[model samples]
Target chain A: MSSNFRLQITNLLIGMCRGTPGLTAELRELGYREQWITSGFPRDVAGRSHPVMVLASRETRHSLFVEVAPGPRIDSDRLLQYTGTTAVELRRGTNLSREQTETYGIAVFGLTEHRDTLRESIEESGVRAALLLCDAEGIRLDVNPFMQAALANIFRPLLPISWAGVPRWIPFDHESGPADIAAAVVPDVVARLLAGETRIDIAEVCREQVLWKLTTEAGKKRLRASVRGALAEAAGREMRKYFSVRGRFVEAATTSSDDGVPLEHRILRIVSRRQVQLLTRLGGDDRNAEDR
Target chain B: MIARSRHHLHDYLQGRMTGTSAGGTAEQPPPGDTEPIKTYLVEVRGNGVAGRDPDFSVVKTLRALVSEPYLKAGFPARVHPARERGLVTIEGRYRGGTPVSMYADCRDPRHWLIHTLAPGRTADWAIGRMAAVGTRLSRVSMPGQLLEKLAGLGLLEGLILSHDRRQFDEGGGYGAEGFMSMQLWGGQSGRILSMMSRERSLSDSVSLSRVHVRYWPDEDDRAASCLAEIDRDGRMVTRGTSYEGHLHLVKVFRRLYTRQIENLESHFRVRADGDAGKLVGRCLTIRPARPIGNSARFCDIAFSGTPPFRLWGVPAQTSGSFTRVRALDLDVGGALDCEVTPEFLRVFLLSGTSANSVVRFLTNLQHYFHSGVRLLDQDGQDVLEL
Candidate 1:
């Protein structure tokens, strides 16, 4: 299979933009204009050529090399190693985090870049090994505690999940009421995940909670009861976007409008028969562990 | 230079302060004495790297105690190996030409106990110096819950708590911060927690930064008591204590601290070798009261190197709210890859990484992210349990 190739742009960097699918929009928001320059094919240290897009940031006067590897495939080891070294060199020279250290800590964007018009429609059912990402609004299907669980499900779903995790108590921020502190920790989150307990109960956590400096005053009973009611309602409302809840326990939610499969089940069936053929021909590496 | 025994060390300090080596009871203070002698207990967590065993050698630990970081952070001192085994003297002069001397017993490989009889201001300064040294060496960190348990051991004298809900999300600008400190003499000490909780603003976000408790060494003898104030980061100031009383307090403090650190290490130890399909054994799930991912501060606080802790590569942020980066721990030169989300952060141990890095990450997260963040063990239990 022969394809048209561009010239190699050796100094065009790669680590600067690895996991950002919406780089163009993000750069614009950060006050940087992206201008694509016609460059040579990106060559690794070993001289193997790959597709590369070189964009110069107009405001910062710095160049960003984005590698849009098709089919979400991992590049060669030599090229991957080169990117690692380049990232190190950039961080050592100056500080980067302080500049972006406020407001929204980091924005979680989702996949499916078909906001406008699409040339080739990527079929959800046909495609295998999809990336599980997060979003702000709409149905929010989040895989917390362990983001790697999604990866593990995608690559090797049949393998038994042997690990468990400790309980984490998260305190809710109350805008009103007394100053006493109340926190909730979802018990058996890891065990539920391991056992594939899709319908999780988040109510017990809110009801049976750790409270500090709480007084059992007869007059304050109504206030205490109201606070507990508000907490349960808030938790259910916040989690409803991710799952289907009947009262306290939560059931799995479907992926999208067209597909009826649960997100968790869909993730497990990522690598299908059609995708296996494509993967074999392309010699895909098992670097699925590296999410970026 | 070094005092051979505990008694010898006390006498050495006595001579330095009094200028006379009289056989007096170093275990009790003189009556009507406005200037009461006290011992400052400084716990230094050892950096267990291969060759630089700071805990084993007095000279090595002293070298670390007076490193450049300490010097820059107001701990300008000269370290000399003491004559006693596992003992070193850190000597420095205050701005007013007041000479301060501290004898650090490095006998314990894990926790180095520093026995010093200095004035109040000098003692506080020395403790500040130890904190500076911890920035390069190892900082003693304990969860607020454990500190509360320790506070329960004796009558509460004082408590200092500071918490900021806006630090992690305010986009580098100031947000809602609450600081409540109380120094009570008798009755107020017991009800301080409840009294402070009355301030609805503090809520559950409060972190116990420092706690002062007065415990009697001999319960029968009321006069034989010490008011010990311990900071969350492992610095302690014990006033009105003899050399024996200080040692007795240190022993108890050491036991609790060791247990706390050990449990933390076991829980946060991220290893590459795990059974197939298992979630990484343990992870820090931070539920920030407010939503994260709006500002860039999260990356800086998580990736940017702070003094001794270094990161090899720049932390890469996905257009989506995610960060995948490798952190180079300068303490042990170990590398670990970390993935950051708006809610959770986990470290992947690469090579030569130590549990110290995990401890540092949790300790800093409290100050930078959320003080109420809980670290979960493999079995889904809180590791901060006393």
Candidate 2:
């Protein structure tokens, strides 16, 4: 059981990293080391060793473990194992501003207007949860207190629903709510998937936020089962154009038209070509701007 | 082209080319207070491809000058190409109803000096616009350490630092409550800095922004009293300084600025390491008072506040005591990832990220997040020697 899970995660890591050559090459030069755990790792319920990949930097002493499709029992054990020893989950914690939230809305709207890929991806995953109802309008977490708390804690910083200038987790029972209460959310998830240096995994995002806080095995199980496929499918739909999906991970598509040009150089090239064209037309033909 | 010589430059600065003044002589000193020169020194990246003669576009820069953002905030300017190559005259009227004229010398591909005879505020407005236009152009950043070194050259006149505490004061109401700006003027200014250096609490609380000083070059024929006011963003205002004196100071300032640029570039330089190329990546280590991993306050202050910095972060997979975030710099169109621990913060810059963007980030980090922040390269060397 452990080998199968480990193989699945190892394959996911290989596919994602290979797709993200720009990020991979850059990270390598910076002295960050990656270790893939294929043998003698921690075990789960069926006595299978946990499959994980760890990326760490020696200078900063920073390490992060990437796991594949973590279930509640093993997730809880891993949380207990790393409890206080420099292994903490990254928290969003009301970091998403209103303008950023609006950008997400725009991105989602553009995606929906251009193609029907998002709706199809969501339908194919068969994810039916209160969170799935989220759109450009706002988030809808119409569920019990426990489920709402689980959803809220799992996705902080991205979905910033606030009151009196402080982030608050609201349980909206009806569709028509206060403007601020119903303010946009779901699009932020799309934005997160689209705007990043490296590919992100749905299972990894879930493992990062869910395990650290949940202590009880029952709570972890319930939270894991609550909205499993919904979030993953939502990520798939939003990242359709900008990213290429490989299993559970979504990597940004590397365009070949630019022929390996770095993103910065590409932008500069466009602006520079435009500048030269404009200068020639403006009749400013004097040269000698180059050093040589 | 205007002859790239000391004599011609002297004539230009003294307004002798336009016949505005008779120019200064050794026996007769130049009119003080009446002929103060404000120079907006800009760093430019190549906008042209390989084998291009005019690597830095003048017409593109003209459009940037008359760009909507600049015109709305500052003034309406008309740009005319000079008879000399890589030179342009900008004539405009400031919003305050003052006629302003500036000479932009773009002879060098690496740097451009925009000189104006208008008020200090006029220079500020123009420089601010240039900074806001695009990533191709930027103000030469003189970090706090550079400012301190410049102060040591001669008598210190004034110092200004905007120590930001907004992250600590999260719930504090709006207005000037978020930051504390302090300015000091007098001789022996090092005394206050010495005190702060000794007191850990005071030293770590404030970040340096601007420094005003008066220094005389060692050359006997040089101007005796050269008054200079330099800020962190590389705008220098000079008064009672001759053309030679100005060039001397600029030479020194450029050397320091070049050193900083090289240091920042070294941090981002990409090189392969043996077989571990797959596992290794660059890391810029910053030691701040508080840990930034998973800190909402750090994100709000660093990414959300300014352009070229306006980015959004998504939580990266992590366990135990480490937190990683993946973010895209929307303004500069670059992507970067950050890892945080209790003692230090590590930033992993990818392609598309510029050294200038990193400088701006480090500068802002010193102001808003931690004033005593120190940058260390992957090998644990000081990138910015503060």
Candidate 3:
């Protein structure tokens, strides 16, 4: 990518989220200040009054993010002040005067995804930290430090995780959850499809699906099971496609059943099997695989 | 990786400039102390490695001070290289039980604090921490490169880290030796702790938060730094010197290192390497002084060779210094003129005499502790009781 793109990505992922409220003092002691960060302001900065980032001297380790979302275009007046930022107050009736309306959404995912990113990164580069574009286009996965690809590329010879953690890629609703949000406007999805109205407002649909999925344990289980089955089927299709290469192959001198199998078998046995196993374990538990 | 890490380090050093969030000041020097003492309050929690890159990690910490009002050049007594030179020496199992290592001459302690983390579990853990702070580091260096460079230099080992600048001949010089430790930081709260070189460039003014350091160490790790001066073999290696084999690496204490600097109260925490039961290094802080007697010269020695030190089978260079060796004495926090005399070095370095263990022996003696100045008697045994 271009240098600016790389810089922006790096900053977005690492800055703005340097410290948790309680952990600021500890981070500062190590010489990393909050000023180095260019973006990713926390929801409630502990010290400031206007969501502005606190500048740390160069001797500091943790970077300073002026505003969690210090994008030249983004106005962060009301999103929320994080450890280094001040909160912005908004007047109810007044229009978002240029500066106040720039509140970009900067939600930290997982538990304290914001707390320890820098400390961990300094000790090891294998950790993953991501800053993504969170909008209706299915939530741009953005730059994720936690993923295998980036970690492997950055810190060669992937180091094992220090803690036992589930290998989870960023959760992406590629299909935009279910066709449920528009169901309110039109109860039957099939009827809407037949009536030539197929575009669904993904944001609304995902919200409804999330609510429905959270309604009861059984409902969530059912949803998980169907997802698992669908994932398994898709994986199977991929496996077949990989193995069924159209090119011809020369006969091997030592023809053997186990050793002679095409490369695809080895690929499936090693790589795809992992995908299938993970899907079975998670999908089955998360959704009602039996019911599906 | 070094470049990227350097970029982040440079940024961090800069960030240290604006360190105003510390909850309180560091521990103050005892009352009646003539000079102020600046302690770097650091806390370390992991077992990763911090490199000895003179150009990057080492210098960044000191260079960050350049932005401050402190004037680095034309330092008063001791003459140092343009770069804040440093040498790492381990006193394994010799630090009187503290597995403490010394990165001598470090003016800034926080940078040194980050370098003390040991190796292993570093790739994931260390890198993750850097990325979190938006830090990019340089690529890892390998042994062949180290060896080639060593061969060219007519040195011994093939391992030359990017930072090692020493030539490994009969006597090693001030350079990067492969036998160095890694730097790291870890914890639930994700606090930082590290060990840096003892040698650093001084700032006109020191960071207040960096002056006092404290940490609730892991008990075992506590012993990691609790060193024993005398080893089991009692071999006269460089127990306190970073370069143990060589007899040339020296720091002649012209005058007791008595700079009356301030003690900006700051607390710190750190982790020690797991190689317990082994000695590491030792550290002692000097209260800033109101200039003391001139010609008060002393020299520290070391050895970085075999037959003397092969503790873990992986030969390590002996590094560390004699504890509390008085370097200077001046009335700090005061406004007054000072004087020096030729008799200062004469009596300080003289052999013992009767009536009094001539206190003058101090000019060259590296004392275990400092209590003003004293002349010693003949045989260099008893104090002159002057």
Find the candidate with the highest TM-score and give its number.
2
**Comparing 2 and 3 on lDDT, the stronger one:** 2
Q: Which of the two, 2 or 3, has more DockQ?
A: 2
Query: Residue A77 deviation, candidate 2, in Å?
Result: 34
Candidate 2 structure quality by residue, lDDT tens digits, A64-167: 34433222112334333322222122112112223222211000111112124433432343432112122232223222111223223322323321111111
Model 2 / residue A199 / CA error / Å: 21
Each candidate's DockQ score against the native complex?
0.02, 0.04, 0.00
Interface RMSD of each: 22.2, 18.8, 32.4
Q: Which stretches of candidate 3 lie over 4 Å from their true place?
A: A1-99, A102-171, A174-292, B1-159, B162-238, B241-386
Ten-residue segment with the worst summed lDDT in candidate 1 chain A? A1-10
RMSD of model 1, in Å? 24.4
| lDDT: the better of candidates 1 and 2 | 2
TM-score of each model, in listed order: 0.50, 0.55, 0.16
**DockQ versus reference, model 2:** 0.04
lDDT of 1 at A138: 16
What are the Cα lDDT values of the candidates? Answer: 0.42, 0.46, 0.21
